[model samples]
Target: MDEELYLIKDAGVSPRQVRLARVIVGLLVLSAVIATPLATTPLLPIPGYMSAFGIAMIVVNIILASLLFAKGLIESKESSIRLGAAYFFVTVIFVPLIAAFPGGLMEAPIIGSNSSAVWLWCSWHTGFGLLIIRYATSSDDTAGTATSVRKSILATIAVVALLTLGATLGLPYLPEVFRNGRNFFDDSTILVPALVFGVNAIGLLCVMRMREEKPERLWVMVGMVAACIDVWLTLYGGARFSLGWYFAKITSLFTSLVVLISQLYGITRLYHGIAGANKILMTQANQDGLTALSNRRCFDQVLEIEWNRARRDKRSLALLMIDVDHFKKYNDCYGHLAGDDCLRQIAQQLLRVINRPGDVAARYGGEEFVVILPNTDAAGARLVAERLLLNLSAASIPHADNQPLGQVTLSIGVSATVPGPGASTSALALAADKALYEAKESGRNKVCTAPRELVTPAPPAFLMS
Candidate 1:
């Protein structure tokens, strides 16, 4: 469920989605079956019906086109861009188609002669079919950068605009599709619808062939099938206001809405998928792989934040820099896996000791760890360090390489300070490190406190041992 289904252009359809697609197609087929019998039966035309239907078609397709355009840019897929362009083409063509619908726009045909409506209808369906074919055949590979995709989309828009204009102005001069109010089946202009039917059938086949390649294309395929049926109904009805004509308009609406709903659902799922992935990535980046504690990077960030807060509040801040005794020797004797487990166990003990919400324990580096304690003085930090050591001793993890009393042990250095104006946080870390070196030099299992002067001290050599 967390998988980014939206990003996957060719993700296979699940069985559940397949069954749902079948149900939708079945309903479309059933509607076609009923409409077939009433194809030529004339019905009373409702005022504004075509205008309303045209507006709804425009709204649905434009929204769907925008969503696909966004998806194409996000995923860098050319197919989505091409598909979006196709929907946009249909949306633009609908404007002229509606305007030319006899008496629909202005009580007289708005843009062209009475026969202009049929010509525009043929032009729209043919152009839409060709665009669908283009989309269905587009490659799934990442086509280009976002910039290039945007350029392509703009170019396609320009081309669609010019095509729409050409069809509107040029097609009206061509031979009439049908006489003013003649039945299309009884006229020579019947060839227009027949040709459109063939083009749509080809588009449906192209989309059907893509079904296995891109599972989400199931919706597109369904839409294409409905489009073919719509045209067939228009052709069979042969005249305006026939039952098939109205049913054809209804089917057209169904075609666009189905794809629009699917896109909305996909985008919603993608948002959740990205959010879940980001949360996991953040956890991985901040936490140590081996010890499951905050890593050095997180420690550094938290130290700076807490240091600034301490300066503002004038409260004491403490740090404990802890190093496991003879850890290299332990790894040499017991292997690296045991060394890793030992670190994890030590981290668990630190977590147990530093119970306050403001305390942070993190792996500083190899065999070295640090704890930041807010509002705590030197005494509190030392007490917490001693508890960590006691907890590890109780675990009794054998380290034969460690001399007498030979279980794993730690050398801890404690430093505490109340920040003053213009003070650097690095001084606290340096002081803790100096104390840790001193603890190791004095003896392996011990604690040492840094002096208040916070001066650099001589380097200790016991690390190589």
Candidate 2:
């Protein structure tokens, strides 16, 4: 079971995502080093220039987070991928409020500011810890199960919103832990940091023990562990306005940087990879391997589309079923290698004849070909089948065992119909097929036409031997 888990993990991890994630992590560390020191500028304590840079970072982080989350939710989303979004969410929502408030990062540490600041601060780290644990222990991205990561994330959001409302509004109804808690920058609450640290420690353990040893996961574990230490320093390292506070702020910023950047990078790779696969699949489905023409599947799809269009628009649709005369005897005489060459030549001739727009020529099967022509009538269909015969006759390939001049030839059956309700399209195909059988029976090399009603006799004009 463990080996199976490891194999899934290894296959799921993308090296491109990991490489890009490393670049983001380095940038994040730099951002933390720069943003935290700027927080202590000797400017007014308003949400002005001092908080401007932090605000910008918060906004950018939010956008990136939303993209990661949307990608994870709609497509094949992974749990760790969602964690990156969760970090950005916490940063954008709570950090801005706390940092913008007076006596927080935006202002000098007031000894007794609003107690609500403490709860908001606690909420950010607590949310962060919970997201980490959720990510680390969640099922692998490749794991097929009844589990839904998006549903779980949404549920987590609802629960957090409820808890926050109770702690903020219903505080009067609860005890000391709920109401009037001291701000971290004011009286410095020890309980907030302790509880959050405890939460993140469990997260750290989960990340370490996850089946996938993706480097991005290790970076998350690093951020979690650093944040816990940062919280501890803020609580027990003495005064609120000391060096410990600065270090804590720096560490906290670094933590967000690590998780958010890596996630964005990884999600970007996943998006492009999925897109490439879809493109390849579409090509394989619609294209033929041998003659490089439309395959049977593509032919059927085009026929249906044209059939519906002709039905509505009252336009004529023509079909031609062309078969190589004496193809099997030719194969028996020269072997399959020459048979393949002969088919390629025939396919090229058909393509040359059906060059107009809305005309589709496809390989129906061995030595049998089909052409769909929209806005073409019975006369036009007959002309196309004649042109096809002339094109092959001009090729002048040797088929000695074939009768007459001992050269290659084609037997074509043309059918045309103006499609409408109760007028079966399958009947048109059957008529063309019947016409082909007639062409084959009357003589091996000729063009036969089957209109909406009766099958017309084959015309003996430009027949090549």
Candidate 3:
């Protein structure tokens, strides 16, 4: 069976997360309530403050949009792509919106009209709410492809551009949002807030419907609730520079901030999960399955690394090629399952005899095992080979085969050398292999050392049972 990859959308929404969302919504509502009495109370007007806030919103929206776009592409979800386009639209429109504000970045407005900023603000909120609704209602049945998603995003950008241009060019024909050119208390201004409130309320409801199946929707719903409160405060304040207007802007920023935080948190969790999986995969790749020793692949890699290190440090590296003696006869008599158990026991004894941090033991192939001992001289290699033989004899694992001792035995070949500057790393293995063949040919149970000319062979120490 194929394993499934982790994605934030597939993550279940726990009860605690749901409770936390409720608590945040309650706090936002309470804050709105506290500021209600001072809604119309005028405060010091700072034009620079508006410009800074607008710029901050643009920056946040751009980052949020980019994150959503990446998430959409990675997960192949059209809903996420649509949501990202919504933020992108808002970001693009905000440039002119801030410039149109009185004494904004420039002394003159981007559009030569007093009420252009109000209209742009209304347009931004209304468009964002509609997009949120679109996202909430999108089906999850058909997954998005890369080409389709990019086309969708480009189309949204083109549409947003045309709408922004139309609004800017036709500002004179649009209904007036401010009667006194500065205050928002006029009946026409009331319509703006009412329209935004209705749109955002619908968006909030749409998000709520999907909250059970899509846990991520909980955060989106909270942001929508904040948007509704922001509109209500705008209506209550009824004027620029009023407490309600200021708090409303804060809530608007809070809406995007909450959603951005959720995205970051989910990405962080996915990163940790992938890191853990990679670690486990690396371990499995290097380890042998049956005996839990390093496999042949790992042995080859380690051998090359150790060989280079020995050449650089002028140290000796030893190789021990070991084979089970008359192992075919044992398997024929005891069955393959018993053969496997016998090999596992022999591997355990080999491990017990060669206890060194710099040593590596690996299953080379069927009925054959190999060991690498770094910084070991030929004499040390011989000592290790003898110890390995003694350990196996002590273990005395039964083998009902043609043998005088009637027990398992090994034929080992030992080779040790300080790698020369131009020596091929494979030379050490070739020499050890030759010695193993020689040992087997000499007798079924004995240790043999290759000729010194081939490499620095382990001293002539013949251990015969």
Candidate 4:
């Protein structure tokens, strides 16, 4: 069963895949660093560096795809943190590498020789895309299916928009814009990536806050602004003249993509954690803290709802209040812990017996329990009380007094009524309490019932005593 559950719930990857994904992303960052100087230096044109960077980027893409495949399996917080760190390292590495090398320094056909550079750039962006999609699609124990899916879709759309804008407008005119000129478009290229970065950074922060279930709109708004800036920068760069302008454009696009992907991952994780907490709360609410049975709150709700329906249709409602005989003495003898265990055992027995629909049982209070039997009459209630008494007595829960009271037993008080025009729950409860008192007086382990109406009679000697 454990294996089956794991299989059913397992995300499509194994632990090995998660480790590999981390290593791959890490290697990409390292490779990018090594290749950056060669590709950007005007004095040296290293064709090998471009290809190496491209291979590194491809490895990043593969890692991202692997993460996506194994999302279900990597649901733990530890796994998420590990993946996030890998992505963060890769993103940070890109800044220095790209900025340092700015357009492969060599004059001879370096641009054409740098196919690996383009591929590497594409790989990083694609890897980011995979991370975003993986987080969106990953199974969350907490969030409902609809909520998880909605957030994933929204994040994906936002990321795609940013990437598309960066590709179209930010890459082409960067050089002309940053050529130390006073032209409006020239200034725009330098300013655009910054603006986009600022927005995405804010967005990333918002996504982080959202994952923590905090109320913040700044991050989301920033992401929107960043996305808009990316589009503007892309278009302006394409029309610019400076070499620096084009570099800024591509870098900005890459940064925005990374931010979008990372933020989406954070939000998805937050949603899942919140959802799991809710389920735990619900489970606790339905259970009894002491005996692990249905508590009074659950019982009352079920009984009232069931009673109302039974009354509407003129069906019978039966109730039995079962009190442990000499429970106080038992606690005094065995200690509170043992008493608690005994109570739990009793509750379990009651739960097992009352298996039929419309039968509700609960721990009424310390040493007292109540069971409701809808569609049952006085006779049925009596039979149930007898069965409960016999079962408890046979169990022979230990009692100090061995002769008269040989074992622990329950004194059951039963009441059954078909609600009519003048029926009252208070009246029924009073009758059951009276019956319980009678059972205690008659003999400790016995069932008792109250007369429907009062009848004058001589007082007992015990009453006078």
Can you give the TM-score per candidate against the true fold?
0.82, 0.61, 0.90, 0.49
Computed on alpha carbons, the lDDT of every model, listed in order, comes to 0.82, 0.68, 0.82, 0.54
TM-score of 1: 0.82
lDDT of 1: 0.82
In the order shown, the candidates' Cα RMSDs to the true structure are 6.4, 9.1, 4.9, 15.8
After superposition, the stretches of candidate 2 with alpha carbons farther than 4 Å from their true spots are 1-215, 218-272, 286-289, 420-422, 455-465
Tens digits of per-residue lDDT for model 4, 66-111: 3422342344333233234324434433432342233433333232
Comparing 1 with 3 on TM-score, the higher-scoring candidate is: 3
Clashing residue pairs in candidate 1 are none
lDDT of 3 by residue, 151-188 (tens): 76687677666666656787767777665665664674
Q: Write the per-residue lDDT of candidate 2 for residues 1-465, one digit (tens) a residue.
A: 334333323435467655765675565456445545443333322334325435654765566466555555554657645564466656444543444245446364322234444555566677777877877777755432224444544665675566556555655663343223322432344455667779878887888798876656766766776677566555543333445455565666666666566656565555556666666668778877778778899999999999999989998888998888898999999999999988888889888988788899999999999999999998899998998888788889899988886998888888988886456667778889988999999986788888567432343456532
Worst ten in a row by lDDT for model 1: 1-10
lDDT at 331, model 3: 95
Q: Residues 383-432, candidate 1, lDDT per residue (tens digit)?
A: 98888888889998999989887899999999988887435678899999
**Considering TM-score, which of the candidate structures 2 and 3 is the better prediction for this target?**
3
